[model samples]
Target: MKDSLEVLPGIELSVIHFHSERFTMHHELFSDVLEVNYCHRGRIGWDMRDGSSVFLGAGDLEIHTMDCCADSTITLPLGGYEGITVLFDMEVLEDHVPELLKDAGLNGRALLKKLCPGQTPLSLPASPEISGIFSCLFEVPQKLLPSYYRIKMLELLLYLEQLKPSHVNRLTSYQSELTVLIREIHDFITADLSKRFTIEELSKKYLINTTTLKKIFKAVYEKPIAAYMKEYRIRQAMLLLSQTDDSMADIAGQVGYVNQGKFTQAFKEQTQMLPTEYRKRCRLRKMEKE
Candidate 1:
């Protein structure tokens, strides 16, 4: 397996594979890439800007678009991870099979998340179907090509749609319940990424008991919900810096940091670089790439 960031730069497809020590990469949007991560081994976490970290275990597969500030990624291979990261263009289905997504309402934004958010990543048993489809789409292995992958992706999405909340069975384990709760937390964070939020407020709004919420949330997502929210806010702030001309103060307030100093501190802690420095670096990188 490749031990570095592998970028397959194609007009319509890209694939990356990471295997090694635990490292966090800060992606300041810019790449209109959508990633599907197949965690074959080890524990991985996506520290999204919406707080609650999304945890992917041995068999979990996650898909989401990459835009400015949409990453808080931890690629830790030592912790038992070795797998494939497939990147595909959003238009693939449209160009190849115009009616596939339209007929099934399968575009991620409109359909998938309503069906399966990072809240409950495609679980192990459910992963092969998505992974196979993604692999086929990207043609990474260059064996079966896109045909097989399309078949797999569509089949997986159909299965995913059936796993939604209303259709979920009560016999599903407590961990499953916690996973559902975590999604609710992410929903809250993403909806109001900049507001002041408290545990009590979160519980009241979601109609959950605070203690039970914390217990289950941390148990499933592996980070306190409050901490998740703060980290996510910082990540979003980074994205805003790279993509917008928003001032530091406004940016701080927008991502829920009440004070400039505190925002800077939080930003530094999560990203290892101060906000100004990060912005400068991003600008230089953007200029060089463009």
Candidate 2:
């Protein structure tokens, strides 16, 4: 695998840990999840697939997305490199997020990728204020501290909002028009999700080429059009399966699947579980907790 994440035992209790022996350790990908790392000392190099080396040392922080992945290797110097890793499950984040931000991230985690494109794997200290908050959040679940966990999560959100990007200059007419096109495209998909459309139609509608449209969509949404559409369909199917009386065949048709068999297959492929199995599992898990 190109990427992976590992946490050592007692890493949380200890102030520092030796990881040089794991020098070549590569982290695995967990789709839609966020991996946060903090470096305590010494540089660890990442030989990125892009042929660039990111050098991370003590006090450097890094965040990576787990959905789309690539191969990279971590090099711990002979002296040994030390760091802490925090893995946040994507579903947990959605469940815990504030209602206002339950949809799109207030500022979006994608901005974090742009700002901290760590050429290296490291988590240097953030502002002491945030460092304290992050430390609390990282340890909360481990300690079974739910109240403190919620507070820490709120603090993290506040800190993230403080990092919001500032507008550098006035918007040009071209930029304005591009913004309009983005809104139109978003609306078009939201309204006609069950229907299929291509980039060609998008290009013609916006009077721009396919490449530009794709670029803009990715920049704003951090996903390819088709991938997002599939995700949307899967989400809709999951909801219908769990909450409504709709049969699998009816649900499939509602979510743009003309073939009941094909819908079932696609749903399984995306979630790694059949719709019936998932619904049952969801209820079972909930029941077990209660």
Best by TM-score: 1
Lowest-scoring 10 consecutive residues by lDDT in candidate 1? 5-14
CA lDDT, every prediction? 0.58, 0.56
Model 2 lDDT tens row, 1-290 = 11222221111122345554223334565444555555555544444443444444555555555432246555453236665555545455544556644454543445345433442222233356546764544345545654554455555555545553342221111233453465478668757556877889878877888987887565334367888778778988898887887788888888888888989899999999999998898788779989
After superposition on all C-alphas, the RMSD of every candidate to the true structure, in Å, is: 14.8, 19.3
Model 2 misplaced regions, further than 4 Å: 1-176, 285-290
Q: TM-score for model 1?
A: 0.45
> Cα deviation of 251 in candidate 2 (Å)?
1.2
- Cα deviation of 228, candidate 2, in Å: 1.1
Highest-scoring model, lDDT: 1
- Global Cα lDDT for candidate 1: 0.58
Q: Worst lDDT window (10 residues) for model 2?
A: 5-14
The deviation in Å at residue 227 for candidate 1 is 2.2
Error of 1 at 113 (Å): 33
